[model samples]
Target: MIQKRFGSADTTGRKLDVIGEYLSMYQKALGNTNFETLYIDGFAGSGEVPLAEHTDNLFDEDVRTVIAGSADRALNVDPPFARYIFIDKRRKCIDALKAKFKDSPNAERVNYSIGDANEHIQKICRAEQWRSQRGVILLDPFGSQVRWETIEAVAATKALDLWYLFPAGLGVFRQISNDGTVDQTHEASITRIYGTDAWKTAFFEPSKQTELFGEPVTKEKVVTPESAALFMIERLKRVFEGGVMDEMIPLGKHAYPSYYLLFAWGNASPKAKALANRLSKAAVKATDRKHGRIV
Candidate 1:
């Protein structure tokens, strides 16, 4: 139960906290196994964020707590070999991560690659070694910075389990109303990630009222954000025949603003499903707290 702050506000920090808890619980329940190899962070930040508290707060904890946890598990488990690959475009962030973890016990097992995550994801997947073993990729980007090609490449791995962030707020829905004439670049990216052009059809379809999870909800109707999210998840499931897109971890509905949607995907094992359900419940509770809604 390690805790740390990120931005001056609590939103990002709280989200990270929940994710860390979920990862820890997941690993613990998973028990000792040879689930080794790669633990990747596509948008690994500078490992810390400078913020101020009443007496003047300055430093935050390493943001790569999940990766660190994986490293710890690797060390204590039967097979003590595991690798951590962190990718970030900012030189400062990469350098900071390197400096922070340089003296850590698992330092040698960690590697940092500097570049756009979308650009290098494919190259990493195509590597000779990744073809084998089970690897988990955590693709948490700011918004839509992650490209479809990158997701496609990672999903193509067949052995990689992807936990991704979907843009659900203003970033994605803003473009939903545009009729067929939206920018091709974004559309292309979405298509590649989704592995189909069906979303385009959603854009043209008229809005409608639908029941989601047995609850009546209404929105633009065509290409609901939930559907878009599920679409991508199903594509990943198909790509990884052995895997399944469990369910959406509802981060609850908030009146304020948030940047992205949080979701997880992996081999649809009982453990994975249980972990996802736990995460979903936690997210719902957190969301309820934020919105002053009953949990």
Candidate 2:
């Protein structure tokens, strides 16, 4: 694949590690069952991302420059998935990925398509074949571009586990923290992202009506990034039956709410919580190691 300008983040390794480990366990437990395991990555960038460029300030001392990303790392998981599907909207990214894996033996098992990731997610869920289509979906958008509706569709699938990379600080939270400078476009975006007009309540207190003109004045409060993240996590937990976002793997030590890893699953089976718990702990440990949380 011709190198693209995009590169992996400092936390990329831990995220992929968590996914690989969890999927390995998943495959082991379900391999003998009637279900087929799938590995899917939406926003699967070029197969290889050079970390050297993206994390100079945080991880410049790390030995590796490039790292194997989700699309490639998914293939590396043990007991290999029965199928792999990678989606990206960029034509160059798709073309680069296709050429990268064209000669691999597992090439035949892959399905690459060019389109919007969220639209394809809903399409996949709505057309799901029940037990025949079990999967692990990765939603690592470039930023907070993922629509709330897409998450709703994925939850409806009831057969897939989701590993979502949510942008908290520099993405969604920042976009709305314009110091009371939110315009109509920003309001619309917040509504779309939350899938409701209710997010205004998180930052702004209810409006007060004046007696003189009977005009309403809405006061926007100071919503910290941390609080914003909690709001989102709670919202997702309500949507996903077995969803968990209590503890997350932050991208950096204290980037004042940077990116985070959130996993969601609706499977009622006992293994669901167990897997979530294990991965969450692992993510915390990984984040600690990065942030000097280690003893």
lDDT of each: 0.56, 0.70
In model 1, which regions exceed 4 Å deviation? 1-10, 26-32, 49-81, 128-132, 178-181, 206-221, 250-295
Q: What is the TM-score of each predicted model, taking all chains together?
A: 0.66, 0.82
Looking at candidate 2, the ten consecutive residues that score lowest on lDDT are: 207-216
After superposition, the stretches of candidate 2 with alpha carbons farther than 4 Å from their true spots are 1-9, 53-64, 205-218, 252-254, 283-295
lDDT of 2 by residue, 64-90 (tens): 467777788777666677888899999
Query: Per-residue alpha-carbon lDDT of model 1 for 156-254, expressed as tens digits?
Result: 665565666666443345555433345776666556555578776654554364655586544443555556666666655655544543544433234
Candidate with best lDDT: 2
Locate the minimum summed-lDDT window of 10 residues in model 1: 62-71
On TM-score, the candidate that comes out on top is 2
Candidate 1 lDDT score at position 257: 36
lDDT of 1: 0.56
